[model samples]
Target: MKEEIQQQISDALGQLFDAVSKLQLAYPGKPFTPDGRLVGDIGEVIASLNYRITLNEGLTKHHDAVADDGRLVQIKTTFSDHLTFPVHHVPDYYIGIRLQADGSFEEIYNGPGQLIFDQLVNRKPTRTGLHGGLMSMLKRINKDVPDAERIPQR
Candidate 1:
């Protein structure tokens, strides 16, 4: 039963991949794919990215392949029209990936690609019986560590 649910989520993510691709193509890179890490960081905001990741398909390769190629992305699959996405600090943290122009589920990163899950997660969309819990969590852990202080400001 859980496997089926995962597949359903994966399939939904695939469709969201297509939908986001069409949206971008229609607007000529105006919008990008959704971020999954943001959702995982918070609540179920994963469904907000307008995309989804296959629990069995794009997991291993995403971390090893795409990210290895100088990319960091969170894959989310869903079956809704809401275009919410989470926010993050790292470059590879919340970047969105979708089916490329050539019908491939490859991940991409850039400006719009950098919207962390926090930015898209609906504040009041239903949470752990609390509001902004996920958002707050993300904000809490995302505190900036001063590299200069650690290695001498000079």
Candidate 2:
């Protein structure tokens, strides 16, 4: 079973590599990073598959997906870093996914947009950006929004 899963992952990665290569060829001067927009796309795809939601992709402004009941969802994904919620076009809820070094992902927070925005507003400003880690943000979200769900690593 593990071998089968590994094979599937390998096949998927191969296809992704091919697609990226073609994209790189198509746009010669544009720079690309694996952790850039690819991470965001992966996050949206995962959220859509796991929750059975429909992704808006480029069709919408800020929100990435539409929930089963028609609520707007804004997905944020990070690999070993904190999320940076955009100031404009905030959605109804935010889905935060963290990609682990072991190739697994954890849904750190899923709740109302206000909870995330409130935390961002209260955080101290840093030279680069907001001064807070994922844990700190999660703590505030959990405290302020009691019904927020944190999915286990899978």
Candidate 3:
């Protein structure tokens, strides 16, 4: 059973690698580094799939997607160990997705835009300075708004 599970895992990873490689090829001159924008694209795809949201493929000023209920969603994804929330445009909600090394992902935080902005405003160095990662932001949210609802990973 263990061997079978391992084989399944290996096959799934191989398929993912192949798909990512093809995607990399599609974007010529772009290096597929861990911290590259392509990884963020993957995160957006994941978020879209998980939330049943439609992505704004081309360049846009604000949110990444509009939820089923018509709420604007800004998605922030990180393959690295940190998360930074930009202070520019405010969406209806913010979805933070953390992609792990083992092909798993965590929805670190999914909450109201105003709550996130408030946390950022009070905690961040400047209005433009990026906020900290998952735990830090969560901590700030918990401290400030004890009754806020955070969407959990599905």
Candidate 4:
């Protein structure tokens, strides 16, 4: 059940990524990559206010991203039904990507690309869900900031 849901999410997010890439390609000067630090979503959102964003692959490995604006973005992703944020210090920004069987993928930009997912059931999705999860994670990193104070202040 969980796997299925994950696949659905991955497919949807992949669609979203393609669309984002196309939009950026049309404009140029903007680069987009995937599978990057989920923490960079913040920088991506803030930077998107001006320069074009590329979906680089660094969005998943870490919790950080670099923006043309010279700012850092830290993105966080979750599959909570209530869309409630964690109380303790968490990622600078949060994104909730619901898993649906629909063929449509929507970015549904909230403030600074921050959004809370609502009413989603837990199910096993196909491998496609991995991709969607990947995008979600990357988006989170893009939104998150490199705060050593919270993670490892070392």
Candidate 5:
């Protein structure tokens, strides 16, 4: 089932990108990169399948999903090389996924949200009150997490 869904997503993305490319060719100086809600929605659905999370209902604050163990999880998805953290509340767990142009993804972080919080707490928040953390930092934090602490992936 997971594989089937993934393949479907891939096909859909392929079509979307093709259309974007055509638009780009028609208007050479314009940027056609898709971001914001669309990318976030894709990340949430895919992360739920990968980590066995139950997604929250529309646009919930702070956390997006709940782990089987009842932990509140903040799911972050990006095509860029970094993940952003909201300075308001620290989630029980955090999962960062980087979506590739090919519709594949890489888990950049999966562990206690405190690790990310601790790193960002001292940093200056942006105008949106979100702190950005680079992939290198996320990978480093992820490596230090013990297997026992990670939410098991499906």
Candidate 6:
């Protein structure tokens, strides 16, 4: 990502956290952390910027973006320690990232979709169809991927 866009994302996330903080202060025990579609959307935007992928418009199924090499990519983002594969179709590529409190992010996995899919093993499918794996486990799996197999960052 460009330095300018990185700073912009940081600023926006700061504003969001501030607003959530105020909401929590008023509500006391209530939680206000951003998750679900918001985090997913942010991840998709960041992935597009960093990887130079073209995002598929209007909630296309299976994959979010397509790379310059014509590979369909599945981008997964989370605030927690897990990344979930909810789609049954394994994408051509997979990029997993975790959002931090300071608006920064950590890339968990970036490689062929089947590599991650193969690790699912005997995991039972959820009602939401999400098959989750720990970030640590994903990192270990990522180590086996040669750089040549990964989508290059812009």
TM-score of each predicted structure versus truth: 0.27, 0.64, 0.64, 0.25, 0.93, 0.91
Candidates sorted by lDDT, best first = 5, 6, 3, 2, 4, 1
Q: Which stretches of candidate 6 lie over 4 Å from their true place?
A: none
Query: Candidate 3 — what's its lDDT?
Result: 0.65
The sequence of per-residue lDDT tens digits that candidate 2 reaches over residues 50-150 is 66468884747778887776777888787656676665434587787776433356767777777677667755556654334665566456555554332
lDDT of 4 at 132: 35
Best by TM-score: 5
Predicted candidate 4 versus true structure: per-residue lDDT over 1-154, tens digit per residue: 5356545545766686678679788988875544333313433432233222333454453223434343333433332221223222233333233222232222312223222222112324444333133444334543443332122210
lDDT of 3 by residue, 1-154 (tens): 5346445544664676676688789996775546646667767767765665677877565688777666778888776667767656556777777776544577666777777776566564656546665566654564444333443332
Candidate with better TM-score, 2 vs 6:
6
Where model 2 places Cα greater than 4 Å from the true spot, the runs are 1-33, 57-59, 101-103, 122-135, 143-154
* Candidate 1 Cα outliers beyond 4 Å, as residue runs: 36-38, 41-154
lDDT value, candidate 4, whole model? 0.36
lDDT of each: 0.35, 0.65, 0.65, 0.36, 0.87, 0.84
Once fitted onto the true fold, the runs of candidate 5 whose alpha carbons sit more than 4 angstroms away are: none
Best-to-worst TM-score order: 5, 6, 3, 2, 1, 4
Candidate 6 lDDT over 1-154, as tens digits, reads 3778878888998899899999999998988878899999988888877886899997988999988988888899998887887646777889999987566788898999888778775677678778765688789988898998888888
Better of 2 and 5 by TM-score: 5
- Alpha-carbon error at 154 in model 6, in Å? 0.8
lDDT of 3 at 6: 44
Worst 10 residues of 2 by lDDT: 145-154
Query: Model 3, stretches more than 4 Å misplaced?
Result: 1-33, 123-129, 139-154
